[model samples]
Target: MSVPSKPWDSELVAKWLEGRIEAAARDQATADRRGYGAEDDYDKAAAEEWVCRSLRTTARESEQAAFALRIKQLLDQEDYRITGIHDDRRVERHVRATLRKIAKMTKANEGFENKLRYQ
Candidate 1:
């Protein structure tokens, strides 16, 4: 997977996640209003599931965004040298490998986000 050319808008994501949580809470309250019955039980369970999924997604995205920002800052330094490592080439390779891993994870997260949208 390739890293997205566009930067992640952390603020935008935060706002979106907030909206999702609020919506989920509203749905859960509606479900609760239906009273304790089979259909109500199902509705409550579904609402809980949606909330859990959203929270999980929010956590992952927040962590990834923070990691990406830190990596970008690290790369911006003029003389970023790892302790006890003199070979710049080795450091470069390690950074590149780490970046690739992050890209792969981000791609997977996008897929999950899409799945949630459709669900």
Candidate 2:
């Protein structure tokens, strides 16, 4: 779409670009609107990270952060970032569940080590 031309000296061009992007959002249903499956893997990871940082009111805030960090790290290793997903609550739940699984695995390993030491 053609942006209205301002005087050559006016930096209104940047503002025009921003407006176009906003209009695109208004015209379409973003991923979060349709749920987690709609978003790409990278976006999902980033959303999970944001959820950990932003969803402070959820239970076990520290665990959420850990999960977020883990997910973001994994995604980053694969070159990913959050986008297109607008729901923070769902992100928090996913991150929490992932963290719980990781925690269980770690605990199991530690228990095994302790038992080996006793033997």
Candidate 3:
């Protein structure tokens, strides 16, 4: 999938992450319930916890994406100026670095989702 050209909202990203996490947890809980051949609260809770633990990497990526987006937005703002950066080159460098970070996060997330899909 192609990354959106428009800027991403941090809140939206957070909500998306929460939804993904919840869905994964629910799927894990259901699978655990099926394997046990019965619905057990404790087992479901344990399965959810395990799923959350396994999704730490995904959560981290979401956080990085949000951070990168925020940095990009700040840099793009006309009024926001870096005190130390007197030259346009330095400012451009910062913007480029943030963009790279966003791109890296996007690629990593896509690869991770693809791995999950094949699994």
| Best candidate (score: TM-score) | 1
Residue-wise C-alpha lDDT for candidate 2, range 1-119, written one tens digit per residue: 12323212112322322333343343234544655566543344544344334322222333433533544454344322345444555544555554454344333322211211111
The C-alpha TM-scores of every prediction are 0.39, 0.29, 0.33
lDDT of each: 0.45, 0.37, 0.43
Per-residue lDDT of candidate 1, residues 44-71 (tens digit): 3343333334334444466555544544
lDDT of 3 by residue, 1-119 (tens): 34655544444444444454566456545655566543343233333233333334444555645554544554465542333223444444544543454355554443222323112
Worst 10 residues of 2 by lDDT: 110-119
- Order the candidates by TM-score, highest first: 1, 3, 2
Model 1 stretches with alpha carbons more than 4 Å out: 38-119
Please tell me which model should have the higher TM-score, number 1 or number 2. 1
Error of 3 at 48 (Å): 10
Q: Report the number of the highest-lDDT candidate.
A: 1
- Residue pairs whose backbone atoms clash in candidate 2: none
Name the weakest run of 10 consecutive residues (lDDT summed) in model 1.
Answer: 110-119
Ranking according to lDDT, highest score first = 1, 3, 2
